[model samples]
Target: MKIKEIQDEIVEEFSHFEDWKEKYEYLIELGNSIELIDKQNKIDSNLIKGCQSKLWLYAELQNDKIIYTADSEAIITKGIAAILLRVFSNQTAKDILNSDIKYIEAIGLKEHLSPTRANGLVSMIRQIKYYALALNTN
Candidate 1:
């Protein structure tokens, strides 16, 4: 599915939850669904810059698409990163570049975050996009 479709689905899914706590719980459940990145790929250089918590993202080009794996030290941030990876990973470079991530707010995430976390989200998005660009270049 497209990124917007994925965001819409997330919004639809979380809208049923009454509060941030429930929403956070759902996000954690979602995060748990993703496979862990192997130790070999969890290098420090792939870590996201500007995040208050340590966040690592690794991407590889496979069959002309980018496949991403990410992890974070914080649960909430890890959930956010997992959401992003689900939407962007396994997509073509052009698809990743063209995706509109603003729907994150529509899902009631970024606005609820602290200023630092909000900035970290933006930085994470930029880093993910940069990985897509790098894959395209290669």
Candidate 2:
């Protein structure tokens, strides 16, 4: 789906939840659903840069698309990471680069986050897009 379509769907899905607390709980549940990466691929060197919490993000090129897996020391951060992964994973490098992630703020995730958390989320998105660029270049 296009990013805008995906954003709309997420907004519609979360609209049913009454508050940010429940939305966060739902996000945590979504995080738990992401497949865990292998221990060998989960090295500290793969950790996202600029995040206050330790966050490991691993990406690979498959069928000319990027597949990402991530884990975070903080639950809420993990959920945020998962949300990003769900949005960009399995997409072509061109698609990812062309997409506008700013919709995340419009979707209410960033608004509820603290300044530090919002920065961390931005860092994670940058890291993922960097990986996509590397894949595209190679």
Q: What is the lDDT of candidate 1?
A: 0.78
Model 2 misplacement above 4 A: 112-115
lDDT of 1 by residue, 40-136 (tens): 9888888878887887888888999888887877777778877888888888898899888776877788663455644367777888888888788
Q: Report lDDT (CA) for all predictions.
A: 0.78, 0.77
Model 2 clash pairs are none
**Top candidate, metric lDDT:** 1
The candidate that achieves the highest TM-score relative to the unseen native structure: 1
As for candidate 1, its clashing pairs are none
- RMSD value for candidate 2: 2.2
Q: Estimate each model's TM-score.
A: 0.89, 0.87
